[model samples]
Target chain A: MASTHLKRTSLYDVHRAAGARMVEFGGWEMPVQYAGIVEEHHAVRTAAGLFDVSHMGEVEVFGPGALESVQRLITNDAARLIPGQGLYSPVCLPSGGIIDDLTVFRLTGDRFLFVVNASRTERDFQWIAEHTRAATARDRSADLALLALQGPKAQSILERLTRADLTRLASFHFTDGLEVAGLRCLVARTGYTGEDGFEIACAWDAAPALWSALVEAGRPHGLAPAGLGARDTLRLEAGYMLYGNDIDETATPLEAPLGWTVKFDKVAFIGREALLAQKARGVARKLVGFEMQGRAVPRHGYALQAEGRRIGQVTSGTFGPWIRKSIGMGYVERAYAPPGTPLQVEIRGRLEDARVVKLPFYRRS
Target chain B: MYPKDLRYSSEHEWARAEGGRVRVGITRFAADRLTDVVFVELPAVGAKVTYMQPFGVVESVKAVSDLYSPVSGTVVEVNAALADTPEVVNSDPYGKGWMIVVQPDDLRELEQLMPVEKYLGLIGEPAT
Candidate 1:
């Protein structure tokens, strides 16, 4: 409740002037909503939504041994990434517990940019620096600001502002030195909303200008400025995991539905052995998606039960606006993780029936 | 504005006496607090409700809150239009957003509720 000492993003003033309801998130004062969560949610789904994601931490790792160091630190195969490509992977503790999930952008042969969660920024930087032998890691979080233009109409809106051939940018690909609104930016055809969008990374001081430009240009396209509330719903509907919520230190990547990112065939990485052992022995619990059968909305920390006994707890839940149902994700007993498995969630001390379903409650056509 | 003719509860519900029955709905203050009501779940008609007990739930995009009954009674009617349009609670809290019509067990219990002035004072709103 005491957020006086919380840090402010570069777009804090802009958010406040727009009448956003601010909340302290991960030690930063960020807007939770500007209009309303449901309204903004539909905006991103039908048209476009602009998001100020400057709070996400950025780390620059550059040296002759950058590739080797990064490959050793991450579970995924960083060697497969060429310049202008980005890879999403989870950084794991040696015991295979997830430290943090991050996106690695290959800038050059010896330079990589890591976009990490704001809450785990310090820890991620420390862990990466301590593990690497020769790669120099610089925390560039304060130097850069990130904006996500997401939705089905995002490309069309963005194409009007930037001269860069956005049509050529594929998913998980980024191009630097793109002139957007006459300002230098690194535009990536990536987003967490499960839509065709772009995330623009630019200088911290230039954030307000870039945000205003996008807002103005995006107005004719039905673009609304969204906040953290809509972001959570959008990502949850997309079946994307949120750090400190869906996956944390207490849960391993294999248990949290991220085993696909853990490449065992790649060179030795931290937690590779433990992950391999877990894979061989099989996991005791697995994360699965579920939809409520009744009107009850599931929430984090809600108990999951089977028959009359508790199985696990819900890690994340929301009234998915697009799906028009209460959807949630939790690590239930592996036996109950199969699609169509019936489960019960204890909401407000009452058991509500729910069914485990395949992930991505909302899939874009 | 708090309606002068309606009795208010500290829990932010308003009740209006209609002969032997009472009309119940959330107050404007409550509706504003629960912005963008996306869903409402009300007790079925003919169901009994107890005073200060949760009889339904109102869900916004970000949160879910229980709706407490202001008086012990039997639900005679529920707003069916809310099933498809819950935002009515925000737009018209006292009119179309009325949650239920209840036949109070005792009409005298309505006198125990606060008047508009007292209820407004409790919520730090000046009495009009």
Candidate 2:
């Protein structure tokens, strides 16, 4: 495919003020980090880190049949969602493969908002609108400003600023109109870090106020303002999936380790029949995490080999900032998903030894 | 920008002769590029380092980069304080954040390094 240009977020000036090193990601000029990736990674692992992810897409699906339409368009059973709950689902293609991984937030009985990845924003919207026979979909990308406050220390930092009892919030649940940092936000206890954190969604103009508030509250708690670099490593460490690299339209959610989100019980949804057939036959390949025996870092699209024969390609690879060892995840034959399978990843013409292991390179107490 | 008293290496390392040994650290330009240094792996004390060889890895929030040794020497000391807190690279990279101390294998090797003005010239920055 052609390389697309990036987009800049509202926090660009704020990042500049904080001395963040900017880099282009999915057409957005975003801070890769202010201090460093590993340091920011360590901070979030030990405490908390702030992330400006406003570049991601937010589409509002409103009308009488909004929830029903979103459910029909995507693979997940969104109709089961009570108001104010969020569910992670994939917009599926006809082949039972994923279009994009998305977060479906049931804001009201007839209104739902979906957050999609930055790079797949256009495609996700097009697919949702085209497939939904019942709902009216509108892209709200220009209106939303998003921040992810993530880590073990996140709850305490948020609790200090918000009037809501965030402790009562469960995973995948959001409470709208919560006051944080003197502004109202649609706060969700969902984060890519796999830690106890919240994704703060607010209006564009209030970005500066929200960013400053987070910084002030985060300072006493060791909350580092992280860039896209630390964000990638942390999400990878958590075994969370990233689109384009991890899975795309050609890779089914079942094959890409997202079978949990595919509700085959949903009658006649997009890709439901194909997914059911695939489920009956079992997936040929599975996504698995691998630990490098050598110091060489594995990068995306690197070749994975077993017994010196290429079996699969690494979809995402990087040094585990906390582990200090090279780690990556990739797809391999289903038989090779078990722990202790020996493999090699080709990095810059050198074959590095890698062994299969369970997902999640780190887990905090 | 280069300090007039400092000698620069193309590998982005800098040295300021302090007594007999040289204090080596990354230049401000290098630190600025690295940004938000999260982890610093300093060379072990007493290790013989070769010119242009990888000495340590400086990990930022986005990527990990090798810190190259600008000159041949035996590492006599390292900044251990960085292990617990690496952001010192961003805070005080020039002084407290010095990466290592080394006894030069050849004192004449220092002559090959660019003087601050020459480094500024090479980087297209007007010499101060």
User: Which candidate tops DockQ?
Assistant: 1
lDDT string for model 1 (A1-365, tens) is 56778989889999999989888899899999898888899999999999999999999889989999999889999999999999999999989999999999999999999999999999999998987788899999999999999998899888888887888899999998899999999999888998889999999999999999999989999999999999999999999999998999878999988988999999899999898999999999999999999656788889999978999999999888888888899999988899999999998778999999998888899
Q: Point out the worst 10-residue segment of candidate 2 chain A by lDDT.
A: A1-10
- In candidate 1, position A88 carries an lDDT of 95
| Docking category of candidate 1 | medium
Error of 1 at B64 (Å): 2.0
Q: Model 2: how far is A224 from its true place, Å?
A: 2.0
Model 2, position A112, has a per-residue lDDT of 91
List pairs with backbone clashes in candidate 1: none
Q: Please give, as one word, the docking class of candidate 2.
A: acceptable
How do all models score by TM-score?
Answer: 0.94, 0.83
> Candidate 1, TM-score vs. the true structure?
0.94
| Interface residue Cα RMSD of candidate 1 after superposition | 1.6
